[model samples]
Target: AVAFCESVQPLEAVVSLMAQRLALAEDVARYKWNQKVEIEDSAREQMIITKLKAQAVAEGLPEAWSETFFKAQIAASKATQKQLFAEWQQHHAAAFEGVPDLNSQTRPKLYALMSELITALHQAWQPLQQPECQPVVDKLVREKLAKPGYKVAGEPLFAVH
Candidate 1:
């Protein structure tokens, strides 16, 4: 019989971190809106992917899986930013004051979250291969994320399922 811990799952923590990371999009969108910068930063996204891919091995994650995962996350983040931008535009929103500096404040928080994610993904690697993975992923995305873009980000964790 499966142990109690085996029956339980830690995927919620992963989805929570994903939601937290996506939440940063509002601050990013505000900063971009004020600075007149495009939401899509190909160079920065590539750099993040490259850096994370390098660290994936050390974190006990497959490089290719990490690439796909982070790419999905970047896409989700960009989608959220664009949605906010469109909403603000429709309302003729004024320049938002008190926006946190994207460089120092927002990026640091993202980096810390990424660090935590690396650790969690390492722990979830085996569990992600189980047949139960798809249902858990669907449920967690529905509960924790509950956003259209997030549905794309939260997909089959491994090819096994």
Candidate 2:
């Protein structure tokens, strides 16, 4: 009987016990109480947590730094990716609409824009693909490089030669 009851009991029932003491109705109160508990715990630990965070940075801890750097890079990459994709979309749309090719006089400007975009793609994708970030960045690069007209080589992504 005990085993049967324990097996059938929802986890929430156990969690809801303390909340019932606070004059809150069971279901709604449980959620509100849990949120308050979480907020209170976070608030109480804020100072210690902040100190630990600072220590992590001051220590130059590789794993922590890698995690934080990856997060920042992810944000930057997303922004850059959006901009690059937008430009690609714009150029593609224009081409589809029969935009005229640049005259010889304007060819340099078109080439410059194209070069800048390629450089942007490299900058955004390369860092993310470094050994530290390989798992995530490699996937993105693979996906992007799969598109027609995109070229990828097995050599180093950057210049050391």
The Cα local distance difference test for each model comes to: 0.79, 0.30
Instruction: Residues 1-161, candidate 1: write the lDDT tens digits.
Output: 54322533567778888889888888998999999899998998898889988887787787878888888888888889988998999999999999999999998888788778878777777667766565676677878764657866776353532
Task: List the candidate 1 regions with Cα displacement exceeding 4 Å.
Answer: 1-9, 156-161
Which numbered prediction scores highest in TM-score against the true structure?
1
Cα deviation in Å at residue 91, candidate 1?
Answer: 0.9
In candidate 2, residue 126 scores what lDDT? 30
Per-model TM against the reference: 0.90, 0.24
Error of 2 at 155 (Å): 6.0
Please report how far candidate 1 places residue 135 from its true position, in Å: 1.2
Candidate RMSDs in order: 2.4, 25.1
